[model samples]
Target: MRVGIADTTFSRVNMGAIAVDELRKHASVAIERVTVPGIKDLPVACKKLIEERRCDIVMALGMPGGKDKDKICAHEASTGLIQCQLMTNTHIIEVFVHEDEAKDDRELAWLMEQRTREHAVNAVKLVLHPKDLERQAGTGQRQGFEDAGPARR
Candidate 1:
């Protein structure tokens, strides 16, 4: 399998680099950096990677500042809802769960709210409880069964 890694900003290059490195251990991987200018670039790069490079899976990486260093997402937020308005070709896999609030289940609601502001459109808002999101949404499309699980716990 060929996996493509994308991170828009240099601030989180370490996180994306670690992910890309780990992915390369198991399959062919291509690492690309997209600019944060707009959502258009993400999908375009994703499409090119998939169609041109034949990347089987595209992993969009971002640093939402809540989770640990290396976590990535299928969606911009933790609710597992993909922000397609930004890019059609990209798939966001994992969101950062804030370390301080992750221990409290009640905070999931707030997390969802926070996620809304992180993206530009802020249109695709979803609940952030890991259990509910997983049970209800089925762990976001494109994730391996083992890879799809609770965000923090």
Candidate 2:
């Protein structure tokens, strides 16, 4: 089994590194990494990892800046990622941490790590043991912050 990680270089946090560590700790699968320049470049990189590198699953990690243009580009990049997933018939767990998510640097860093690591675990479950997901179904499982703990039971 193999997992792919497509990350961006423009991010302040090293989300790729965090993901690598988290994935390695949880799964024994081969990991493929592609570091792109920006959020917009992640789709092609993820496709390459899936098609060329033969990763069973992929995670697209990006941190878009807190600017108007940055937000627009992030949305465009997300759309492209969706298209890539449809074209390749692969699952891409998008872990996007917008800079505007937190005003404090410390909080932003925490959020980045929390989100990336959580998604990495999800990627592992998708390819390795999907039944784990079924167990958590409707449990309000969330990444990057406290889970809502299943909506109104």
Candidate 3:
């Protein structure tokens, strides 16, 4: 599977590198990293990666919570906080399937979606430091959670 991982910064690209390495162990995977300049940098980068790299999936990674105790205190800490940590370091947005290609195999789309979801969720849990994320955004109440979106793709 050719996957394009997008992040605003090189840090996310680095994480994409790690995810790619891991995916290689289980399936055929290729990755391209894109960097943009600014808070809204990810969208364009994501588009470019999808078009240029022709990735099967795209994932957006972000550090939504801040990295300071004060930052964490800002959020309404709760068990079911639906917060999306923006990928300050890096993020994957979507998995791209060309219309021509997707039409060839519908199952591939499902599989790609599963893999994309898994990659995003797992990468966040395994790659990001829980303490740092919690302290940064003060989502302490939302700690030790698993969003196992898929059964390991």
TM-score per model over all chains: 0.40, 0.96, 0.41
Candidate number of the best TM-score: 2
Taking the tens digit of each residue's C-alpha lDDT, what string does model 3 give over 1-153?
455665434221234444455555545456676644322444655556556676555564322222454234223221111121232233344332222323334444343444445565444443333464445353222111233342333
* Tens digit of per-residue lDDT, candidate 1, span 96-149: 333344445445434433432232111122212235344546443322112444
Supply the global lDDT for candidate 3: 0.42
The per-residue C-alpha lDDT of model 1 at residue 16 equals: 48
lDDT (C-alpha, whole model) for all candidates: 0.40, 0.93, 0.42
* TM-score of candidate 1 against the unseen true structure: 0.40
Ranking by TM-score: 2, 3, 1
The order of the candidates by lDDT, greatest first, is: 2, 3, 1
TM-score winner, 1 or 2:
2
Identify the runs in model 1 with alpha carbons over 4 angstroms from their true place. 28-41, 65-153
